[model samples]
Target: MEFSGNPALYRRIAIAVTLYINGGAFIIFALIKYLLHGDTWVLGWKPVLVTLLFSLWFGRAMYRWMMRLDAQYGRGSGWVLESVRVKLPELRPRQPR
Candidate 1:
């Protein structure tokens, strides 16, 4: 889950997993249809295209949502691209005399 620390990696994995599950399920439907009958429109290029498009839209929304989450719980009250540039430093504990 720490891999999600990197926004790019997190987004990529999220999108990949989403599309993979949807795509795999669609493929299974197509295969089952083919096995049961001969051919069907349930599985084809259109489904894949539509899924990809939906995945893109989902990714965009997720990105925005994650940004907002980071803003709310991470730094300040709002989300800004500039936030990425500023790194928060960890404070070290002083020795107790």
Candidate 2:
């Protein structure tokens, strides 16, 4: 999971993450357009185009950010969202009925 030794793997992970973010952005943008325009087809290409460009533009920044985060958190833990990883409280077993 450590990206420091393997640059190829690091770049690949960044690409995958970029694609995922681009997809999600497109979905949200499209939904918003649908709600506002009452039709998903109208100017639909704009969202697709925008998201594509957005991904391309920010992809490098993302890679850099990931590396910084990886350095900050260390041991590849940065790839895993720390905020999303919460300690779950233990649940006691219910008494047999």
Candidate 3:
């Protein structure tokens, strides 16, 4: 079924194309690097660790940006697939028995 005026077919196609292009570029780069050096050490752990830290730090910002974009342009399914939103609230301290 169609969703929120978005044609599922077209949405799927666009997502597929976007994933293909980005994923293909990553694969190509990795393959070339592997072929040339035959080791991941050139990429190195420090840079990878920094990237992971950056991703963790900025992931929320990225998600909010995408949410705003979706709200503005009426694009994206926006957390529909997952039931949870806004993260689970922190648990409160238990009362004394």
Candidate 4:
């Protein structure tokens, strides 16, 4: 829908989301490996290359999702962060048993 809009912004957001997800997953995976082997390991280029290729698809998916959200909420990518603020419910004290 926003084919004529700011394509750079969408690409940036999608890449950022992709990196965040992949980075977090890599950290968790490394931790798991360390726990199992009791040692840390250096980063590998093969994995990096693999992730880079995978992220292309993931980033496109993220872009599509964001576009869908933007259309559904009638807001651009910039507005989604502030416009969809969720108010927390007040936590009251529980009654005594």
Please tell me which predicted candidate would have the highest TM-score against the true structure. Answer: 1
Candidate 1's C-alpha runs over 4 A off are 1-5, 72-76, 79-97
Q: What TM-score should be assigned to candidate 4?
A: 0.49
lDDT of each: 0.68, 0.71, 0.55, 0.72
TM-score of each: 0.52, 0.51, 0.36, 0.49
Root-mean-square deviation of Cα positions for candidate 1 versus the true structure, in angstroms = 10.9
Q: How badly does each model clash, as a count of residue pairs?
A: 0, 0, 0, 0
Question: Residue 61 of model 4: what lDDT?
Answer: 82
Off by over 4 Å in 4: 1-5, 39-42, 65-97
Clashes by residue pair, model 3: none
Q: Among these predicted structures, which one has the highest lDDT?
A: 4
lDDT ranking, best first: 4, 2, 1, 3
Which has the better lDDT: candidate 1, or candidate 3?
Answer: 1
- Looking at candidate 4, the ten consecutive residues that score lowest on lDDT are 72-81
Estimate the lDDT of model 2. Answer: 0.71
What are the per-residue Cα lDDT tens digits for candidate 3 across 60-93?
4444444444553435435355566587789999
- Which pairs, if any, clash in model 1? none
